[model samples]
Target: MPGFDGACTVNESVKIDHPKLVKLLQLAYSAEKAAAFAYIGHAGSVRNPDEKVAIKQIEMDEWQHRETVLSIMGQYHIPTSRYYEIKYHIIGRIISCSCYVIGWFMPYYFAGRLE
Candidate 1:
């Protein structure tokens, strides 16, 4: 758990249990789950076999990240809401469709912006 920065991380003596932290963690977990789904959809739409494989790997990584976040939330005794999960799930699908239409330009665009 080295370099873990989220709530309930091992480095801190005190655990986060605030309502706001709970809500934020829930939102972040949902977003990570959504990203994983979107990556799957993007991988499906890609023509290049290598790109598809790489995207699938990324999707798996996202799922792992989500699990880690969920575990942290669990440590805080925070419960995840099904409604928010479903809402973000639909939004993720929409993003995936949009990525298909846009030829997956978002990654490149964001990379350029970040640099």
Candidate 2:
């Protein structure tokens, strides 16, 4: 949206094409799946019951987000990819391992950088 829009065309009726949305949704779906996996690993590694529960809840939220993206893909008649799912799962595991090695500060640092 930021890159596409040049000037503010509030009066103009511009509809984004299906393909762009589909691609964006697909990426989002993959990311959500990866995040959920990472959260599960993080939750498993934690000793504090409350923190573990919180991370698991976050994992559930990510799963729900994935489902939402899946629903949108269905509505658009876009096919899901098994390959991407497995690939992202592995990536997520790698991320989880990195976080484990870095400890709690890693997430916060990354969050700040991302923001």
Candidate 3:
């Protein structure tokens, strides 16, 4: 079968065993969700209006990344791990709460380090 660009289509039946890559993508999918959740609290905690908007924008970007990761996983027929989903949700909420108590600088610092 020729692809739209006039090249032969790659065989979909050719399965490549890339456990590490799949694992990394799964981790990324959950991590993006966590980052988005954390950014919500970070935006709320900040006093500066511009900073809040930037943080919210970052949150939206994280969501977009998550969706992209999900789409890739779907293409590969990979399932989302329930353990990772639950774990990251807890971690994200914790970070969100910490953003309120730990002050503003740490959220940016941790976000920078994580990203």
Best by TM-score: 3
**In model 2, which runs have C-alpha deviations exceeding 4 angstroms?**
1-17, 107-115
lDDT of 2 by residue, 27-96 (tens): 7787787787677667767799999999889889888988998877776677677776777777777767
Please give the CA lDDT of all the candidate structures: 0.75, 0.71, 0.82
lDDT of 2: 0.71
Candidate 1: which stretches are off by over 4 Å?
Answer: 1-16, 107-115
Location of the lowest summed lDDT over 10 successive residues in candidate 1: 106-115
Please give the distance, in angstroms, between residue 65's alpha carbon in candidate 3 and its true position after superposition. 0.5
* Residue 86 in model 1: lDDT: 92
TM-score of each: 0.74, 0.71, 0.83
lDDT of 1 by residue, 5-49 (tens): 776746543456587877888887887877876787788788999
Clashing pairs in 2: none
lDDT of 3 by residue, 1-115 (tens): 5457776666453333699987888888887878888898899998999999988999999899999998888777777888888888887888888999999887776665445
Q: Report model 3's TM-score to 2 decimal places.
A: 0.83
